[model samples]
Target: MPKGVYLRRAGRFAWLAFAGALLATPVYAQKRTATPQKAVQQQPAALTIPSDPDDAFVALREAARKNDADRAAAISATLVDYPIPSYVEYFRIKSQMFDSSGQPLIDTPDAEISAFLQRYQGEAIADRMRNDWLLVLGKKRDWANFDVQYPQFVLKDDTQVECYALLSRALKGQNVAADARAMLVDPRYYGDGCVDLISYMAQSQQIQRGDVAFQARQALEQNYTTLAGKIAAALPDARVDGDSLATVVKMARNDPSQAAAYMGTISGNLSRDEQGAAWGVIGQFAAKKLMPEAAGYYRRQMDLGGNQWLSDESQEWRVRAALRQGDWKQVRQSIESMRPELRAKDPAWTYWYARALKADGRGSDAQQQFQSIAGQFNFYGQLASEELGNRITIPTRTTVSDAEAMAMRSRAGFTRAKKFYDLNLRFEGNREWNWELRGMNDRDLLAAAEYARKIELLDRTVNTSDRTKAEHDFTQRFPMPYRDIMQRATDDVGLDMAWAYGLIRQESRFIMNARSSAGAHGLMQVMPATAKYVARKIGMTDFSPSMMGDPNINIMLGTNYMSMVLTDLDSSWTLASAGYNAGPGRPKAWRTSLSRPVEGAIFAETIPFTETRNYVKNVLSNATYYAALMSGRPQSLKDRLGMVAPSAVTTTSLP
Candidate 1:
């Protein structure tokens, strides 16, 4: 063929081939692209699962949260081979042992619960289950099982369970009246188990009508009519139901000018003891409001019978009222009138009682009392130290040998505690650690703390050493972790490093990943929103939310925030510490309410919020010790506290 013709024929074949390829491209592309897209879409779920156990655990948790026992049982059944298998196994057993409602599967309760306790025996969950079982046994009034299980219940602090134990004792012809009376102080806290015990006591005449009426008065303090009614139901002639006591108490507290009317109302209708209690309530309200007339009211109640205002609550109010009015005579009288156990429980009252003696010209007796509590690491203890002309300084500690340390770890309690920590049950671990050391002498506890420190369980080390009554090991009590970062933060913000350390110790106990129920995070427990606001304010843009647990960023933000609060709080660490805990507004409000300058110790004791009150005292007291340790000299806690008084002006600005 000619060359041109051949070339044209080749071009024609090429066009045909190109057209064919174009026709095939979409199908080929669809086949290739669809495979990757489908896999990518599937990858999200698949990628989330690192392994079969992880995937199964995620599903198990979701089911557990929903209380979907059936699904959980199915998922957890095959997870027996996983690490931490006990937790997974619990889900399976829990599914059958508890219904979807979390109440025990009533039909099959006995053997499975026993098996669980026998299997998980010293584990935290076992005791928790025992708590549930005891409640169930008590509800059933199966006294034999309740007794059997009650002795094994390690967390005996459960008031309801305590009540149940009392109920069991009552079943055996024993009078639990004194125990019942002591625990009845907080009537508003009665749950079903406790209320049942109260009913049992009332039916057996173990709880008197007067006791019922007294508790009713306590209920009235909270405006908890339901609690009052519960008491009234148990004792028909108790006279609580007819008093409308909550109404009278609220009226007295909120509108004190009508206190006269309420006072008359109580005396008019209530029984003798109830009337005395009513007067005590009025005295409490009056005292808190700084009414000078409160002393006369308390005196009138005292005249009814010595036991009328004999309660811890009533007598504390008497002391507070006297303290408020500067009546040194009544301060002494009221302090002496307090129950011996009550006075011994709080050093503040002891310190003040000594001061009262000193004011009344009994110098020798005052010195003796102040010297007794002089070395305590608390607000009153520090104040008492100042009264004795001493400052809080580093304590001499007996060092532990390696053999002693090894022996401490070999102890059953320490070994059990380490196991619980390994399981990440910190509460259980700490409880076990402390529980085992309950009866140890000071040196043994220090040895135990050394063991905890050896294992890097820093919190237990501090806590164990803190339990000593006659010994003070400052190094063990306040170990400085992340000291370099903390120092940098203190330097940067011009804040006291000791104070910052003290706050962090209280806030998180130096747990790097500590979080609070209020969503605070890190060692200082700053809230995320607060952290971001702080970050923006200080030009701190070098971190993200994940860095909240970072020692540097957390310390930086915490110290800066603390510095801001310190300035706005008149440079008093007492007020600043309170502000850091509760908020800036509350401390300012609390100070402005003071009619005159008060001793810093008085200011701390008078804080309305119990949590904030304790937080302030503890932070300042801790800083005092830390200061002594850091500077190698005795530090004046009084200088740290200075004086808390009404602000010169109502300052509301905060950083």
Candidate 2:
């Protein structure tokens, strides 16, 4: 075959090969006329092969296979003319390269691979190609970089596990045993396999055989219980001996109240390790809900100094039980007894300690404790602040008479209902539309009515189908102070006022004292540590966690943090919203690594988290409606708040 002709032939063959078969196909011919006068001659109709791009590619494949260079070239040319469907483009590109005999090219240059990845960025094909490149690179150090950079790309198979294991071993050099154990515990590799693998390997003394038992033990402690029972069942038998059995019996006896029944039933003939495991099972059971039983076993294990390894685990269980039962005094004592190093590193402990202090009426001390944390404040601070009588404040933009507010509310109400009507029209066939409307009817109608009342208080008139009833309901539930705070914060942060209201609504449902499980506090759910940092930056001295409960402080800090996150994330509200819900660092990293700019809608849809995705939609939609209500003008919330440009004011001082 001619050198250049092979390329064309290869391209065509790729287009034709499909569904496990290579078939010969006839090529459509274009007719030509010698002159315009002679061109009156009739031509054959164009062959209407399947219009799908995949069919076109298959046709191209058949032509290349037959070494029909002209047909292949024509097909390749044709394929390029159509839209490259996301799925088949990879196969199409590969089929384009050919060797001298018109065979598909075997090896492609790294640069070509990189270029291909860039061209098809965000597609699954790009991920596969990138993984292949990383494997080819085969540098141990690069594996982590590759994993972190392309988490969505890595192949999840045995090969992936082995590759990570090898990389871990190589990185650890002299401590391959530890590395292997670590790899097995890593969520990416071991997943549910870690629990059984650790138990089995430990019983067999595999780490001891490799002179890395200590390191292996560390890995086992962190991940063993995370494995599922199904995977654990497949583990190798645990070695049990007489001495181990005796130790287990003794451990069981130490927590007599909890494990006494289990101890009585265990076979006396069992070896020491078997008894130990039996006791472990008893401990596990107690940990679930029978804390008394678990505590007994843990105490026995603690007394047996030889099993000091279980000390930390026992204490953790005890602490958990105490917290579960809301034993504030016990929680305080347990946290105080814990090593300062551990308490400092674990946010949970710190938060609980602060909570305990607050519950004990040491409010001042609790506030100080909450204030000390920088990044790790969680729900504890929120609870502490609320108990201390702190309420977030929203500053009013302008004083308006009740009549003015009522008039504004009427106008906004008309716009909102109409928008919903229009949206229903646009998405008449969409189930999601129906779902949204249903949800609005179930709950948001009341919230919207309340918002309308606030607008009405500002002398706004909202004309709608059920204006009288809505007005009555709104008047009953509307809180002027809260609405004022939301409006002021929105203006201060240069955010759309409606967006701020929407965020507050979704975050805390307008409950000034609401606290989330993740430690977000107040109406705006400002994290305590975040609040402290903002407070310090704003030159507020003697700042206390109690202040976070204050409406003004909460709004100020939450808005400031929102502004900071928005600035850091390229001003994209979608990413900023993600950061707000899931922390700023993760979304920022995701945004930086994305090869293609995500469309706002598609980005929200593709968000890996269900909570964050819904949050973005709710926040944006709420903002849109709020803006319509507040401004008395129909405008897109996304356009106004989607990407904020930095203001001329660079200082921390509030406007």
List lDDT for all candidates, in order. 0.72, 0.46
For model 1, name the residue pairs that clash: none
- Candidate 1 wrong stretches, greater than 4 Å: 1-76, 79-108, 118-126, 187-189, 223-225, 237-241, 256-261, 264-266, 285-300, 303-314, 401-425, 435-444, 454-456, 469-472, 541-545
Per-residue alpha-carbon lDDT of candidate 1 for residues 33-128, written as tens digits (9 for 90 to 100): 235544553444432432477577656755655545556666787687775555565555554444444543334346877988899888766776
Runs with alpha carbons beyond 4 Å of true place in candidate 2: 1-168, 176-206, 209-260, 263-281, 290-292, 295-318, 326-347, 356-368, 372-378, 387-389, 392-655
Say which candidate scores most in lDDT.
1
Cα distance off (Å), candidate 1, residue 440: 5.1
Query: How far in Å is the alpha carbon of 446 misplaced in model 1?
Result: 3.4
Per-candidate count of clashing residue pairs (backbone under 3 Å): 0, 65
Q: Lowest summed-lDDT stretch of 10 residues in model 1? A: 25-34
Model 2 lDDT vs. the true structure? 0.46
- What TM-score against the true fold does each predicted structure earn? 0.81, 0.34
